[model samples]
Target: MLGVKKIGWSVLLSLFVLVACSANEKEQSVSQNDGGLQVTFTTPKKVEAGKKTEYTVHVSRNGNPVADAEVIVHLEMADMDHGLNGFRGKMTESGVYKGQAVLPMGGDWIAYVKVKRGSEKVTKRFEFKAEGGMMSPEELEKSGLHENGSLKNPDF
Candidate 1:
């Protein structure tokens, strides 16, 4: 009976660790709905730091694609104050907008996608991780790419 109980506890511990690790893994895509608008944001399974990566956002309303909306993606470090990085998304097709961002470092980051059509506007936030090498705050500042507060270059 003692041996059986030990084995059971070991299995439970292993399962708990597995679940915790999986929960921390970054999601490649996330979807959310506000009012009647639905937005789906997608990124690469693994985003590398200091590399330009493509981001995609799909906007729809009432199950129909929204092709006439302006879309923009803003990125910021989740744990630290990295200012605000903005990327203007260009519509590639109906309901699909694509943009690129170069993450400053490898860590937790949030992407906020803003969609606007006429007077209707909605914003969605997605959290993900960037892998690869890390950079110091000083280096990021010297890179001449980091902004202070608001978006310095929307075209970037």
Candidate 2:
């Protein structure tokens, strides 16, 4: 009767609204590169302990960049007194994240990269070497200097 028609219209309208809202709520953060895949890291791979370092990640396929992707970074050092307790980063840009981590000491460390785009996820691990002896240019030259402040073995 009339009540049945009204109920059908109401149900259809509710479904439409739900679909529209869900479409707007989709959270996607992954970009496609060229034929291959690549992630970007803004921070330097070499850093001194206790110093802050930042990094970022991006997805690409076929040498083209893909936009809007979620990337996460994790750092771990085995020699430090703290074992994986201090590590965190934020995704500041699309398919990019900034990270601040302190190099525990001079040794080998493991850095992890995790990226997600829709249902696809990529994870990679990299090894980093940290050491002491932060020297100036003058000091470096001095260390490599000869007795006469010239080349030790001149070849001319």
Tell me, by TM-score, which candidate is best.
Answer: 1
Query: How many pairs collide in each candidate, listed in order?
Result: 0, 21
lDDT, candidate 2, 1-156, per-residue tens: 125774465346445544544454432223323334576544363444344455555556555555665666666654333233223345565444566554433344566666666877776666554444223335424544232222222221
- Model 2 error, position 156 (Å): 59
Query: What's the true lDDT of residue 52 in model 1?
Result: 72
* Per-model RMSD to reference: 10.6, 25.8
TM-score of 1: 0.73
Best by lDDT: 1
**Model 1 Cα lDDT, one tens digit per residue, 25-106:** 6647999997678999998866766677899999998889999899988888776666667588889999999987777655
